[model samples]
Target: MSLREAVAALVSDGDLVAIEGFGHLVPVAAAHEIIRQGRSDLTLARMSCDVTVDQLIAAGCVSTLISSFVGNSSAGSLHELRRRVEHDDPAPLRLEEYSHGGMVARYTAGASRLPFAAINSYRGSDLPTLNPEIRTVTDPYGSGDIYVVPALRPDVSIIHAQRADEHGNVQAWGILGIQTEAAFAADRVIVTVEEIVDDDVIRSDPNRTIIPAHAVTAVVECPWGAFPHAVQGYYDRDDAFARRWSELARNPHEMHVWLDANIRGTSDFDAHLELVGHPRDGRLNVTEAFPSPVNYGGRR
Candidate 1:
């Protein structure tokens, strides 16, 4: 399926959607597609909540954000997010903050179909005071006080992978960062990849299969799906573009112009690629050249 189609089909209004990536393979294209489709009143979940989350908030596509931290790579805080929460610019953003470990526990619990997850975090922090979602639970083994967070089962989970088969078997490497858990926890999963390969290629390296075909609802072959963010083994992070976004997207008017020119203006992902410059231009090539061979059959 196409990126636009996948976003339209999988993501819906008021859905709890999670587009997650740690440092690499961020699903920026899908987020843009959501904005282009004019989906609003969404509750977005992510770990770091990088550029995509910021843009979604600026576009008024989001009403709530669930995450540990939200920041640009080197551009400091996401000014748009700050403005929404701080000044209530476009709309007031309802926040559900959690510690890094607490979020992981929540996703883990959801993936495992558990009601809640207990962790020994936020003991001395003000998260429990600030966020009511953070609750205390008694240890079953009588170990005294414990902090627990509810499972985060998103309505849809969109993730960008390095490669995938037409059957939706996703293969990703480098900085996965809770993608598997988020996919497993979601009711529907949409995977946008750099390329869709033969089933044999995916089967050859089964270990790289992060999200199996059964968990995926849609498979989109979107080249440069993680534009402006690094896709390990495929391309380097577009730091210049990231910085430019940080500078220009602070103002609401500038954000509108940026979205109109780059997102709404482009007909499809191919047009987006052309506007952003070709991936083969070498500007976004990987800094390191470590080519690890895929060992299919090994005698241990």
Candidate 2:
């Protein structure tokens, strides 16, 4: 299905949406589509709330954020996030703050269908004070208390990958940040990929199939979808756009003007890319490299 259809069918207003990828492969295109569709009051989640989340907040689509860090990944602050937090400029943004470890444990617990996860991460931290959800209990069999974060089961989780087969079997590599856990924990999953390959291609590299088709609810083939964030084999991060966005995001009106002109002004991501000077031939491509192929013997 198209990204439009997927988001429309799977995502709803006020949904707890998780768009996961560490430093790269963030589903910024899907984010744009959600914004284009005018989704609001979302509780957005990611380990690092970077440009993607910043844009959502800037557009007044997000009402809350769940993550450890909130800043631009490459440089500078997420002024929009700061604006909402400090002044409530566009909207009141609630936050569920946790350490990176705490968030992973929460997602892992949710994926495993557990109630909560206990960890030693918040032992000496002050995050628990600000966010009261981080609680503690005495270990039944052991000595002392431990901090626990509740499970984070997102209503829908979106991820961008290098490729997936028509069956929605997703395969990704390099800096996969809890994407598997996030997808498993989600009630529905939407994957936007750079390309869609044959099942034979996905079967050729079974180890790379991090999220199987059974867990996926929608598959969207969107080349350059993870643009501005490096997709493993397709393109490099668009630092130029990020820098410009950061500067514009400093002023709320300018930020919305930019968003209106660049994102809302276009029909789809491709048009937005064209408007932003994308389709840079050969410039963003990575130098070709391949690893040794391992054989999965058949016909025993």
Candidate 3:
């Protein structure tokens, strides 16, 4: 089956999809394709929201969101979500704020198949105020410190990596970042990679291979998959686009127009490439001029 199909298999109506990546690096490309194909009543979990969140929200694929924050720092700002929340829209966006360590602990508990994991990171913090479900239970073993957090098991997990084998072995390159836990906790896994290397390359450095083939259901080779988002040394992020999106998002009409022009109405990345101009041989011209922003009936 194709990588998209493999990823799509894990998604269903009303599934809670947990995506592994921060800002832009290592986004679940195949999962996005699946979402574009149309699924409803979806709840998304991520460290922070960015282009991926914007695209899913614009597509109307996401019914709820669970993240610490949303919007691109480089983008002018994130107002759409804030406005929606402030207005208390019927389908008000669900914002679950958690500390960095708390988020990691939740994912780890999910991966371990444990009912809850003990942590003392948020003992005196406001994190519990936002999420009252995170109970402060005493240590069963009589340990003086540490509290337990309920396990978080998403229906499916989609992640991106630098390389993978056809069998689905993934090399996260030291920035594992919740992927290992996500893989352990999710019912299914779908992975996308820059390239599919030989099994020998993966076997040679077993420690580097974060996700084993057994855990991954699909492996797709997607070059430049993390466009507009950075992948460490691989490519510079499109901070300009992010900034513009943030600025336009303040006005709903303008946001829709911008989405239509850039993301929506476009079939795939190739079309997006045409709209934004493709990088020359995997190298972008930082000095090259960018297109002027389209007017969307909002403050410019």
Candidate 4:
């Protein structure tokens, strides 16, 4: 399915959507598509919220954020996020703040099909004071108090990968975030890849298969899905564009104009890719410098 189709079919208003990526491979394209489709009152979940979340917030596509940290990766503060939280310019963004571990624990519990996961992340902090859900769980073995958080089962999760087969078997390299857990925890998973390869190629190196095909609901071949943010071995992060977006996001008129030209104005993902000036001439290709290919076929 196309990126637009995948999001339209899987996501709806008032849905909890998780777009997982650590540093790179953030599903900005999927988020843009959601905005273009005019989704509203969405609760977005991310371990580390960055420009993508900021864009959605500016576009009025998100009303709540389930986040550990909300800011730009390199830049200090995401303009729109700050504007909404501080000024409530567009709308008041209801935030569910958590530690990085708290966010991860939520997904882990959901992936494991458990009610909640306990961690010692928010014990000493003031997070519990602000958010009442952060509670203490007594250890059954008579240990000390530990904090527990409810599982985050998102209505839909969109994950971008280096590559995937048509069947939706995703394989990604570089910094691995909690994407595997996020995909498993969501009710529906959309795996958007730079390219869709043959199953034979995907299975040749099984170690790269993070999310299997069975867990995926939709597969979209969206090249440059993670533009502006790097995709591991693919392109380098577009710092110029990121800086421009940060500046434009500070003003509502400028931000909307940028979104209209780049996101809403574009007809499709490919068109947006073209609009952003992403080159397909092997400029973002990855090279395997390491020559070793080990096989622990039968160590036991």
Candidate 5:
């Protein structure tokens, strides 16, 4: 089956989904399509950095979110998310925050199918303030400040890569992280790729292969897969939109309007492309209308 179909199949109401990517690379397009289909009561778990989270929130597809941070660049200040969670309304959103390392560790534990993972990172810290479930326990073996991290297996894991074969062998260009762990831990795995290369390409560089075919349930070819975001040699980050999102996030109503115009209103990537012109040469020109921090290292 196609990656899109696989992703769509795995998604059900109230399923916890995990996505792999950092900032603007290796996001699962197929999974986003599934989200676009409007499955209700979905929870998303993310490790550290991703722009897609904002897209999901803007879509109103996410009911609960567990992540280390949420912002334009790197956890770009989750202003809107905070508002939804903190609001004293009929139903407030649920949010669970974790440290970057803590998220990694949880996924790692889940992937390993272990009862729990031990870590000293949160010792003597207020991490429990964000998540009361985390408990500190004394280790009989004297392992030094071991905290039990519950396993985090998700209903599905969606990941993106530079290349993949028909059989689902994936080749990531750089920066392999908890992706493999998440894939292993999830009940289903869906992958999106820039190209469907021949098996020989993967066979030639066996060592470079990160996700083998058997672990992948679906693969789709999505060129410029990480549009408006970084895609290694193909393109840089989408600074203009990132800045606009950061600003809009500050205002809930403004964010809704922006989402309605640029994201939800659009059907496909082409529509998004029409709204935001292609990058000139290798860079995107930032206009005064979308003001960004001077140090913002987005598209530039």
Candidate 6:
């Protein structure tokens, strides 16, 4: 299915949506669609929010952000997020903060159908004070006081992968990140892949099948879907573009102008790629590497 179709069908305003991919395979394209559709008042969840989430924040689609960290890479301030947190530029954004470990535990709990997850985070820190949801409980095993975060089960989870079969069995390697847990925790899962491969390819390497078909609601084949954020074997991150975006994001007017021309003005990701001189003249492409083939075969 097409990404636009998937987003339009499954995503609704004011839904708890999560687009997870960690550092690599960030679903920038899907976020752009969310912005393009003008969906408002959404509660977004991500472990490492990064620049991809920043785009959604800047667009004003997000009402509340539930995350451990909002900005990780770009080696500089994510200006739009900072503007909202400090200045309340466009609107007042509510933030639900947690530690990286706490977030993972929360997602784990959500996937496991638990009420909350206990972790050793924020013991001496003031993060607990900021977030009222963070609670303390005495360990039943006599380990002492424990901090726990509520399970984060999103209404919809969108993630990028290297490939998926027709049945929507997602295969991702390099850094699998939190896509699996996020997908399982969500009510609906939308997977955008660089390619749609045969079932045999997936069968040959079961270990790489991160999100199984039964958990996926939709599969979108979108090459370069994670542009400016790399897709492991497909392409590399576009740091220069990211830095340029940071510069524009400092000023609201300039930021919107760039978005208008690059994101909203374009018909789709392919058009955006064309407008930005992508294929990067073949510069962003990665070289193929041969790996030892593992047999997942038996007496058929």
Among the numbered candidates, top lDDT falls to 2
**Which window of 10 residues has the lowest lDDT sum in candidate 1?**
287-296
Order the candidates by TM-score, highest first. Answer: 2, 6, 1, 4, 3, 5
> Model 3 Cα displacement at 4 (Å)?
3.4
Error of 2 at 8 (Å): 1.1
- The C-alpha lDDT values of all candidates are 0.88, 0.89, 0.71, 0.87, 0.71, 0.87
**Per-model root-mean-square deviation over C-alphas:** 1.8, 1.1, 10.6, 2.0, 8.3, 1.4
Please write out the lDDT profile of model 2 over residues 49-90, one tens digit for every residue: 888788888887889899998877667889999988888876
**Cα-based lDDT at residue 11, candidate 4:** 93
lDDT of 4 by residue, 1-300 (tens): 988788889999999999999899888788889988999999999989988898888788999999998777766679888888888876788989998989999999999999999988676799999888788888998997888999999999999999999999999988999999999999999988989999999877889999999999999998888887888877778776777777777778988888889888988767888887755655656675543786737656
Candidate 4's C-alpha lDDT?
0.87
Off by over 4 Å in 2: none
Q: Residue 53 of candidate 4: its Cα lDDT?
A: 90
Clashing pairs in 4: none
TM-score of 1: 0.95
Between candidates 1 and 3, the TM-score winner: 1
lDDT of 2 at 45: 89
Q: What is the lDDT, from 0 to 100, of the residue 72 in candidate 5? A: 60
Q: Better model by lDDT, 2 or 5? A: 2
Clashes of each: 0, 0, 4, 0, 5, 0
Could you tell me how far off, in angstroms, the CA of residue 86 lies in candidate 6 after the best superposition?
0.8
